[model samples]
Target chain A: MTGIRRDFQKILLALLLGALLPASAWSKTVIGVMMPGNSAYFQEIHQAFLTTLTAKSSAGTTFEIIVQKPFPDPVALSNAARKLLAADPDLLVTYGTSATLAVLHEKSHAPVIYGGVYDQFTAQLAGPRATGCGFKIPLTSLLRHLRELKKVETLNVLYCSLEEDSVRQLNELSELAKEQQLTLNRINLKNREDLKKAPLAKGDAIFLTGSSVVAAMLDEILALAKNHQQPSVGIFPDRDEAGITIALYHDPLAQGRKIAEIAAQVLSGRAPGDIKPEALRNTELMFNLKEAKNIGVKIPFQLVAEASKVIK
Target chain B: MTTTPIANSRIICRVIVLLLLLLAVPPLAFAQTRELVIGIEPEHNIFTQMEEYGQLVKYITEKSGIPIRLTIMSRYGEVLQRFKAMHLDGAFLNSYTATLAIDELGMAPIASPVSLAGESVTRGIIFTRRDSNIRRIAEMRGKSIAFVDPATTEGYLFPLALLKKNGITDIKTFFSHHFFTGSHASAISAVLDGRADLGVAKELVYQRQVAKDPSIAAELVILEESPPTPETTLCLKQDLPADLKRKLIDIMLEMDQSREGMAVLKTLGLRGFTRADKADFNIVRQMAKEAGLPGRTSKRQ
Candidate 1:
């Protein structure tokens, strides 16, 4: 009877240890990150996420960060997402609207954290396991700065016709312009050549939307803006120097940290759905004084003083 | 006994929560230690160049409480690339690079170095050996010329536009050979060494070199000079926090007021830094357009 009781106790202890071992013994967490491109902004998000996760993991959870090669288009992004999903990562992090959509399309049960997206709601990325930061350039703020920069009777906007985010931003701007009683000229850019051929009237300020095509053709567009002497405003903070008179955009590092915080919450056993998608809280205004002068617009000293950076 | 088990379970839960809190705190604290990175284009021996700006870097860091790192890019193109990559938080850029950063990177100029003469404008000078007979711009046709990188506003674009205005429209046809020596000093050295009959460089650089070595003035004669344009600017990436930006600008603009700050400015060959306005670089953009060169050039040559 004594021998039997001792054997029974040993079996019960083994069962308890087996139940606890999976939680305590599992040392590594695998995270797969998909980025639209290997641009500096995306890299900042990636680095911040890894640094935050590694430093925060209290369980000494080692992480294997698998970064998919950057994809240029939606199709490439979808394909890369499929490959990353096949590896069965513990979590998925994506940068940009297109990349996040690609991961969502895969229907992977893994939690998805995204950053660098302009409008997550319009992108329709709010799935049960998806939540991250979105940078929606406040039109009111942009228009206010425009008013300060120039007395605008007409506001010209250039966007890529095919990009949903670009169109959405254009529509939003149109509504805002209507409320302000400002005339908005919407120019649809189909290709790089379209930017060069676009007719920009004098005394019209151009507004740049969050369009990949427009971002790619920024150089030509700025050159065109210079030639036409058109004062332009852009949503991309990074391209402030690219000839846009003003750029209102989010801080990439801050955005990265926000996404990392969400990732940490998910790692702490909170479902992604428990976290609401956050809009960019930190908006930076950059003034290109040189571009302003080239376009023949006078910036008020107050506006210049308010700028986060002034490129003179 | 049942109540005791429930209490023990609650204690276990509290311990677990405490452990989670402990783990999360350090990383969050570490993330707050932001780094301010500055990119300086490699114009000379990088070590010496860094040493020159070391005091300024220290002063900025001390004032802002943010650690600063200065990255010297190997070429002008690299400097633009780093800025575009958003790898740099701030930069000391030439007028052309500063203009491009404004247009392409949305970088804002905070301040610019003021010369001892109280002028922040620098002009381009086309020079040749005093003994050379290439007196007129047209006379140098089919002769070799050396210019600092094509990205330079004063050293290349402005002077190149001047050449074009003087009826040298086609460089290939007008000059037998042309190359970029990569730096103003190198371009002047090329002309002095007879490696190239004509060289273009910033007048400020030439003057500084002549001041250090008077023989350079005797050997090189100015063939033509371009109009005064904005000097090198200290720029910051637009995405930085507004408070940090203001602090940085204040520290830089007021650097001359303090002895330590003046010492740092002296090392950088400047009297002090003055607030830069956008109109300062209008001539640079105009010259770029007039030169028929793209406002932003990827190639250094």
Candidate 2:
């Protein structure tokens, strides 16, 4: 009888405290962000998104952001999604295609904001209640730029089997390479250990797909490339000085700004379904002339002139 | 033997023939056999410079029927010295070095490469970030500065002259720190990234960077711009055969007229070459004079 009376008294005391406190004391908007990894591209997007979101915030509205940087894999990404869902966040933000899908698979009610995914519609990652910005870059022009730097024979493609978007990019390049009459050597990097299996060789170039796995192993892959004197091109511009001989990709700044716009609309009580998704086509083309020189290749002037940035 | 006037005449005739043959052989051989060795000044990228000059040299050799070889100087200031040390027949030089080479080495300006925009002249610019609070020369006092190579007019001499004209002498004390960034692009980068408070670079390079990255346009402002100066000019040795120099000038000036020539010009990121006279370098000479650069060093060029 005393234990039951004590439990009833505790519940009454919590109800009284809740009634006395302001709603904002416990009703802060919580946003959870799922990142595939700490890739420079994602970090740039995330920073810009936060800055814009903070600036656009209303007078009294507050945000509580929970960021989860999970190792780029299916299981970890799903676990990250479940953890975020458990928070009952008002919105879920995702960077990279893998994380976006993992979050979508959980059937959450919160609006989803996705960024840094390559070809969102083509990869079938887009869905209802998901309004955000994704990017599309021309792989043909990337190959053309690579060819301008050197005569590519057996183009080595570095991709991860786990990343759906990465696999989509690789498959796209493979089809294009066939049309161009160029041979391809696809090296699948499933995890960290697979980085050592890449056969970095001479007289050919490496094409790095937008896979988190490849990005995680970029340093070692580029080192092997440099050690073997094989030039490389990539879809991601890592810090603008990844020793990537050629890079052509959408600007992270543009993607981030667009994402923040969509997110602000959602925060303003608009339906995610009402806000139409947009695609970013503005791309940045860079040539690492220094790396080219290190590998004993001279980028022609005509092509150099075309690059948006040349690291001389 | 008996001394005779006829025998003496025959000996004199033979001597005259031998002397005439000796004189004729050397002139003919020098005119035909000697290959022209040209020097390329150090630029932002050696490989780029080499590829550009290499394609031009190959084209010129094929067209002019004269063997031409290219050599790159170790640095920007060695053009005139290497002209003597390496027996350089001519060189493609920026306005600063071209002016110095003309005044000191007696080199003649043959032609200048027109930019892809068809501009044969470039200007010097002093720039800084809008937020850097370095709007004027007075504001640059005690601040860091990035200057391009001393061998470039737009990079170094023009800025130096402007500062002296503003009465800010003794740069060592005027600025807390100053160093050469070696390229106009580097100087612009230093200013944009806040590595330096002020930067002096070629206006062409600055514009090129702005075109590449639009954010640079928002971040930086041009504080000053010098009068137009000659772009890279082909300055040939004074002793080169007049015909050879004319042939080179004609080939470059007429490059855009033919398909093959246009292809080569495209490779070098140029529209074509235009005639450049010593008078075209007057702007550079005046800038150098204002900066008090002549005879500043024993190896001035």
Candidate 3:
């Protein structure tokens, strides 16, 4: 009788273990995402990430996403990063260079996947627990496009000198201009009120950099440039929708998909450091014909034809 | 008769539990195994085609409550073979293959892509480099011509039939040489590189290419445009349940109006999808017959 009782107890224990094993194996993966703000660009990247993650999830595996509210400033970003790290998520996904830097600063063990960063090298995003994709519009391509639109003998670039990424981009543009034998005029925006005081000369086209201050003050700058009849080019492709004559940038949707693929690799047991961070390869060109006409620039048929999107 | 009342109650309880357990098992098993397999013709590389159609498959899965598995067949014939084996639950087929599937495999035409202009038809174009001395189809008596693929309707059949109708029959002897370049882009490249004096492609692709490189306009000239052909079709297996078929057609037809659906359509280079039937592809059948392609109706007629 005691032997039979022992056998029954063993069977019961085995059944309980079997039930718990599946529950543990099927538990959904938790991904915590930190975003800079709810800007349209960030939202697009977020949407692409969700769409791709859903599409790539395996049959039995599922995902649970925890998103931190948009951090408006550097302090807010740092606080959010600390709080998110406290949650002990399986992985962390961040957007923009500042937010990514904040997460890296936390020094969490969770793997970090980032997107929409301008320069990953300068951001120092490569580490044992982090990998990301960057978007950098090559200056040579932008200048070549500008040269095709009009004979740009002299180009003026307006940037906020405080931003390191902006300064780097300015230096790159200046070097590229030297190679092309075109004169580049550097204009510094010390503050918001400098837009009205900046020297705008006729026959000098404007080059917009990837600067937050410049983005915040784009409307006034564009109005000033238009008033001066200076055809302007921007780094963000969607800037064309806001009246920039020519905008060149990497495809954000593709970038999001790339980040998701890397995340999938990490989730499937690959170390994050094993995956090398990549820059976006596919570039999209946008042209605003109406802006071209307003600026008294004739966009060549070839440039107009090659554009991925055109705003009239 | 001699059993106690408590023993009878226990027996009744055990019988009821057994019945409940039997009732739950079949549904769990069915849910675990249910999946919809969709086959697509490889117009582009498999990865790209999958990426483009990813959202469409997801949308279908969400609406139909069925998991969708996509299979990209490397060739047109492989898709037909898989359908005959009953391995595919549905397929996205070109007009010719859709017509064949409807006639031979009992497939039902559920939906087809429509252009942004609200047109459900596409045209084939024959083009040559502007510097090429060949002016017309008749002038290409001894020049090499490039075609996308023999199985491609607009890229091969329509354009070839147009040439034959213009009295350039006996292609082997009429043209010095002809070759299949495997894709419309390749055919265009072949012509531009001067390997072939003329090439044929779909009008929409040509226009998109020109839009991306206006230099094509300065270099290549459209020599002829074929008559309009019906667009590609999304087909369903006839054996699918009536309610499920209705749900799928409704989801596809309403795809473009929603944000997620619009993204899928844009990726697939389509404006939207519209409900379709077998009658819409009669023109494709006629074109196939004219082109002398081998299929059920072509063989029968």
Candidate 4:
């Protein structure tokens, strides 16, 4: 705790030094973006944010963006937040719930815009200088659809304890399992070693929670699941790329454009408190028909017909 | 008891008469022995649609005291073909097929399913992606369009009528390319993913897709929406008993009032059924007329 406090003090002094720059040095607006994990989803969002921010800006306006990608652990998250604060950007852009909280934990006066968090309502991720977009996917719907793909007596949930969104999903799945008359096998994958140490996966199916840690190890998990001959689902934009049987997730491009909208407003001298924080409820459900075929499972025709996208 | 010769002869005559009656009026005999078969074409998926139709058939049979059966048609385009070979008392037909049936076979629409939005009618939509440069019908020239099946009123008729009204009589000359998506959701998906520059589909389906994936709203923009026209309606053969049709319509329209009726509706994914009349399908008729669609004679011809 003392070490973190000392780091915070150093970051504050650096921010003070940044504030002392000349007017010419402040001609171009600098925005610091800190992402917990360098996941493809985050990268897509960051790219969209940049594209939209550029498109929505004035004819000649350009931003000097400083980005930090850290491994999403507690210490790394704090360190990433401190590094971004040292830059003392005009606004702080964060992806994911933990990254947002890390910036908030710093107690920085810099305005913050967050995106890609799940169920911001439950987390109350509101602050005086922070406003952005998040999403709420129906975890129960994911479970229901997964069961339709295969008769699930036992469901294996792969989540990371370090990610707040994944933990919330884990808890939600636990409740849903009771309602659906299903037994849950919770797998907390904090690191790569934890995944290696996981017991033999014998569940009827596997569910991939929206954790970067878990997403990073998706190929290994999917391989093991296929070896067990179990169908798998995910709560991200896996899009059949990693052989996830089903994916129900928010549209990252939508969230990216929305976050850019908020960030642009903050840069244009609008208070974050004035802009209302929004939670995007638009979720896309996709079925990877080829993946199901590989796992020797069949997705119901109704589910296939109802999906927004089907990869065959 | 001893049987008299007169009684024995009377029994023989009665048996011969019964056999002759069955042979002479085979249609009436079949009607007496068989349930009313109502054929349905796929709205999205045939399996789910059949299940919903099954619940509806069971409900109507119980309430109207008319034994009803449902038949899943091979394709939406095979309505008149199926009715010709099969003894169908009625069918749950979409606007285009119902209009064609009304013209060719004298089928009258009695009731239409109320969508989950509480509306018994739906509209046609012309849409394209938000990032696409095609907004006006003129801009769609030399660009591909994704259309639902030709048998669908909202999918094909609406756009056809719209183009004709704009003086583009020949689609082959105007459009660079076009294809049918076989389903409304697929048609919308085509435009959303940039597979097609423009798409025409049922407005209710577009709304449902947007509800499921709201990002669709963020990505696509509607260029035009047609006036509300009847959705799928329960059209019965004109030769059916008038009292039976009345009873079925009454039972269907009252489905939202009773718990048992509501349960059937829950399975059907519908709020309720609403009474429909010939005037409700004027827009479809107008579109067909504008599109210059030829009405084919019944296969019985």
TM-score of chain B of each: 0.85, 0.85, 0.83, 0.83
Best by TM-score: 4
Best candidate (score: DockQ): 4
Task: Give residue B161's error in model 2 in angstroms.
Answer: 43
* DockQ of the two-chain complex in candidate 3: 0.01
lDDT per model vs. reference: 0.77, 0.81, 0.75, 0.82
Model 3 ranges off by over 4 Å:
A1-29, A37-39, A58-76, A119-124, A160-164, A181-183, A187-191, A194-197, A200-203, B1-301
Cα deviation at A121, candidate 3, in Å, is 4.5
lDDT of 2 by residue, A200-268 (tens): 563398999998778988888888888878889887885848698888877788688889889999877
Worst 10 residues of 3 chain A by lDDT: A35-44
Candidate 2 TM-score, C-alpha based: 0.51
What is candidate 3's lDDT per residue for B1-301, written digit by digit as tens?
5999999999999999999887776542343347878888755335566787777889777756778888887666466689877579888877767777887778888988888888877788888867555687778787778887666777777876776677766789987778876556656655654457788987876776677656577668898887777776788888777667787788889987788888878877788988988888777777777766665463312
Error of 2 at A45 (Å): 0.6
Measured against the true two-chain complex, the DockQ scores of the candidates, in the order shown, are 0.01, 0.03, 0.01, 0.07
Rank ordering of all candidates by TM-score, starting from the highest: 4, 2, 3, 1
Give per-residue lDDT, candidate 4, residue B125: 93
